[model samples]
Target: MAVWDFAMPSPLHLCRAFHNSWASWTASEARLRIATSASDTTPLPAEAIHAPPLPPPVDTVYCSTDAGFSGPDRSPTFGFYVRSMDGAFVAAASGPLACPYDPLLAEAMAIHEALSWLQEHNYHNVQILSDCAVLVASFRDAGSYRSYLGIVLDSCLRLINSFPACSVKFVRRGSNLVAHALAKHVSAVEARTVWRDSLPPFISPAMI
Candidate 1:
C-alpha cells in the first residue's frame, strides 16, 4: 500500500491524487484502507467542519445597467451584460450618449439594448438582473410607469413578454459593478447603436 500525502489545495487536484492512489494500489499486492489516526479522532474546528456554501451556480445570466453624465448635467452612458452559469459571455449592450438627464431613461435604454441583443440571438429563458429598482418595479406593477417612462416601460414589458420564461430581478448596487463598468466604457468610446457578444479584456477577469 502506498501512503499518499493529503492537504491538496484544490478539489480537482485531490480527485486526481486519489484516483492515482487507487490505481497504484490495484497494481500492488497490498490492499489499502483509509483509516484516521488516533489523534484524528479529535473534533475538527468549526470552520474546518463546516465549509462555506458556494454561491448558487446559475445557468443564470447577469445584466447590469449604469448611467453617466456627459457634462456633469446630461447623463450620457448606459451599459448592460448577460453571462452564462460558468460566467461565460452571452450577450451585452450599451447605449452611449443617451443625453437623457433622467437616470431611469438611461436605465431603460440599457434594458432595451440588452433585450434586443438577446432577441437577435433567440434567447428566451432568461433572468434579467439589474440594480435599478424603479425599472424592475415597473415590470412588477403596471402603475410604475408614468409620462415618458410609460413609453419606455411599455417597450420593456413587450420585450420581456415575447420570451416564454423571463424575469427581471433587482440586486444590490454592489453586485452590479460589471454592468456599470460597461456603461462607462460605452460613454468613453461614444459608441453608437448596440454592442453584443464581445467582452472587454478587463471584464473577463472577474468572470468565473
Candidate 2:
C-alpha cells in the first residue's frame, strides 16, 4: 500500500480539523473555475476586463446585493439592484448560483455576479453595497489571501480595480431589503429574474 493511504484521515477528522483551523475567519468567498476556463483568474474574465481611460465620478450609481438559500444543500441565490444617482431604480436581477457554496462563499458569489452585471452594462462608476461586512472587508486584504476563498476575492478585487471609480461598501440589513427580497424570492422559486424599467409589485413594498 502507498504510505499516504495508510495515514489518510477520516472524513470526520478532516472536517473537524478544517473547521477548527478556519473557525476564526468566516467562509464568505470561494474560488471557482468553469470547465472551459484557461486559468483560475480567467474564470471571472479578469484578463479581458479593461477600465476606461477616464472613468466617471464615484457614486454615479448605487448597487446592493444579498444572498438567499432555499435549503442547506441547495445552491444559494443572489439578487442585486441598481439605482441612479438620485435613487431611481435602474435595474434589478435575481438568480440561483451556478454551484453549491457555503453561505459565506455564496454571498461572495453574489458580489461577484452583481459586479459582472454592472460591468457588462458599462456601469464603471457604480458603487456596490453588501450586507455581509466580512466579505466587504475581504477586498482590503485579498492580495494576501491564499485559500479557495482568496482566489474568489482576488478576482473580485481585480474586477473592482478595473473600474476607475467603482467600489464595494458594507450596507446595513435595513438598507438592503430590496436585494434581500429579490434573493429570497428567487431561492423560493428556484429560478431567476431580471427587471429593467418596470418592476413587479411585490418589489415595491421592499423598496419602501
Candidate 3:
C-alpha cells in the first residue's frame, strides 16, 4: 500500500470529499427507500377485501339477470345465469324478445323467463339478482304496477311465489355483468341458447 498522501489531500479536500461521499450515500439510501416503497405500494384507492355474500340456505340456487339492447328501437336480448349457493355453475339461459320492449319491461321479462326455466327444472329453492332498478321497483314500489310493464312484473312475482323458496332482489350493475355478457352473446347469435354443463366462452371471466 502507498503511504498516506497527506500533502496532496489537505484538510479542505478531505473534508470536501467526506461531505460529498456522505451526501451521495444519503441520496443513495433515500433513492433505495423510494424505490422499495414504490415497488411495495398498492394501487391507489387500495381496494378493500370484502367479505363474500353469506351462503344461502341449503339447496338454494343463485341467479342473475340482465337485458342487452342492440340498437335504438330494436329488439332486446335477455340473459340469466344460475349457480349453486356454493358458486358452482348450475345453468344459464338467454333469448331474444319476440317483440322489442323497453328496458324496464325487458328486464322484467328476463326475470320472468329465468324464473320459468328454474321452475320447469324443479329448482324450487332459488335466489335471483336483477340490476334493473325499474323492474325491481315494480316489485318493491307498489305504485309502479299501474303500467303495462306490470304484466311482466306480475308474472315474475307469481312465478317467484310459486317456488317453495325464492327471492328476487336488486343488486348493483357490476354484480350482474355475467348476465349482461350472456345477453350480448345471445344478441350476437340472435337465438335462444341454454347451457346445462359448460357455459359459453364469453362467460369465462365470471368463472375466474
Rank by TM-score, highest first.
3, 2, 1
**What are the runs in model 1 whose C-alpha is more than 4 Å off?**
1-60, 73-75, 97-99, 186-189, 193-198, 202-208
lDDT string, candidate 1, 109-144, tens digits? 677777767777787677778788877877666555
TM-score to native of every candidate shown: 0.61, 0.67, 0.67
The lowest-lDDT stretch of 10 consecutive residues in candidate 1 is 29-38
For 1-208, candidate 3 gives per-residue lDDT tens digits of 2246654566787789889999999999999999999999976543445545665679998999988777555668888999887788889888887545577777878888899999999987898899877667678754457776767777777898999888878899888888888887734337888989977777776432
lDDT of each: 0.68, 0.78, 0.80
Per-candidate Cα RMSD to the true structure, in Å, reads 20.0, 20.3, 14.5
Q: Judged by TM-score relative to the true structure, which candidate is superior, 1 or 3? A: 3
Return the clash pairs for model 3, or none. Answer: none
Top candidate by TM-score: 3
Question: Residue 189 of candidate 2: its Cα lDDT?
Answer: 44
Off by over 4 Å in 3: 1-55, 71-73, 142-144, 186-189, 206-208
- Give the better candidate number (1 or 3) by lDDT: 3
lDDT of 2: 0.78
* Highest lDDT against the true fold, candidate: 3
* Model 1: pairs clashing at backbone N, Cα or C within 3 Å: none
